[model samples]
Target: MSNGPAGHVARSTVRPNYETGRRGPIRTFLRSADGILIDSVYDPGAVVYGSAENPADAGRSPTRDLVFVVAHGFTGDVDRPHVRRVAGRLRAHGAVVTFSFRGHGRSGGRSTVGDKEVLDLAAAVEWARGLGHVRVATVGFSMGGSVVLRHAALHSGTVDAVVSVSAPARWYYRGTAPMRRLHWLVTRPEGRLVGRYGLRTRIHHRDWDPVPLSPAEAVPRIAPAPLLIVHGDRDGYFPLDHPRMLAEAAGDHGELWVEAGMGHAENAADDGLLSRIGRWAAVKAG
Candidate 1:
């Protein structure tokens, strides 16, 4: 709940206007794509760029601008460094909104890895749309990336562009060499104690389900909307091949950025990466 060293809390700070303490009104609506009315809210600061018409609804608009939505990684809130960095850059250009996942930070319920996150994303998108973000773009990290991928596949028509940095399309984490070790390390009594007793985190189920709830199963359904896949060369956790697989599934519609020394969406404030993402979003939103 404290700000970063720079005094910025990214998306964690509660907006005074949203008296409920939850972002927006925490409302729910049924999305035609998924046949579910999910929870969501419009960011008070979100704005439409370039077009007068809302991006979610295609119609005559004064400007066809874009809004950027920032999603955080696993165990991370909207105020994490990565989210803050991206939010700062995107906000400098226009409206930028970020929110915590359910059961994470200020939201309600427990983390569902990437499954329930789809609902969280739907809510965020709906909120952005309500704020007049006619052209919506998303930037997500780690597990957040997987959520974005799933959302795009389900609501391709509404999402104008997506930037998934450090997301592995297919999940075989328990099979990866390092992940194998890390899994052993984390699932052990000591690690489990830290995550459970120390952090008091709850698992969806105990034992036997370490395999990431993969989003690769949803990749084939995503396309047409421009997607940029950014991965670090040293990300042993997600594996480099994961991005390659996701890009391949994109079938010439997606672009990949493997940073030389980057790791898991690190250095998000770097000028080059920021510029690339911003430009990519601009072009895609158009």
Candidate 2:
């Protein structure tokens, strides 16, 4: 719930800005609970430790105590510009961790879509905690959005805050053309070739043995953890009803923001919107 026991670690003006003085951006391979290799990156923002207490840092978010683990959309990896941009914007508010799900990018295995991706996010969150950030938040886009909600529900108090952007409310949604195309890509053998060589995403052929919990179904279980549901009014992949369903399931614990003229996933997210999200995560997670 409320940032666990370290929710209010005494902000001392003494610690060093360990994020800086490091050799380079933190990049490493992490192992999921299921032993899958996950490629992860950590971007330490330019803010120094204890800087939040400075008079000059008054208006801006100086969130050294928080880390945001960002989950990319379907076919997305940590290397993609859109995913990197999301990491860049989030780092302004705190340290950021970005990772490629299993079967995406250089990672091993095939994408089970939103089902097993929860393990990938869990691995990233564990790494964030290992980095010494007491508070952690997860921000996911589209497919990744579904992963974050399910991750929160399954992992319980592992994450302090959760933000799902442009995510579908349920699984196997074939309402939109994009959704239909996506299903074809995942379900068909030839389409799997397109996903592998064309999209650089290795999609699993087997269907979910047991369907994982849907985003809307998982929302109620994420209660007490700060949850933010964001969608674009003009999103092509999933309409406003998707976010509405998730928000309704969240009841009083979740916050919703519907942007005007926005599209879908990370690409549709602008700098201003990302900045607002970063600020919200900092405040809520801190």
User: Per-residue alpha-carbon lDDT of model 2 for 61-123, expressed as tens digits?
Assistant: 333368899999999999999999999888788889898998999777789999999988988
Candidate 1 TM-score versus the reference: 0.71
Cα lDDT listed for each candidate? 0.63, 0.86
Alpha-carbon RMSD, candidate 2: 6.7
1-286 in candidate 1: lDDT tens per residue?
2222211222322343435322332222323233322223223333334344546544423222466777777666664566566676665454566776654554556555667667677766766675565888888888788888888888677788888888867654675675676454355666545544544333333443544445666666777788888888877677788999888877777888888877665454376787678778877776
Top candidate, metric TM-score: 2
User: Model 2: number of clashes?
Assistant: 0
* Error of model 1, residue 208, in angstroms: 10
RMSD, every candidate, angstroms:
8.3, 6.7
- Write down the worst ten-residue block by lDDT for model 1: 1-10
Model 2, 43: alpha-carbon shift in Å? 1.0
Model 2 Cα shift for residue 153 (angstroms) = 0.5
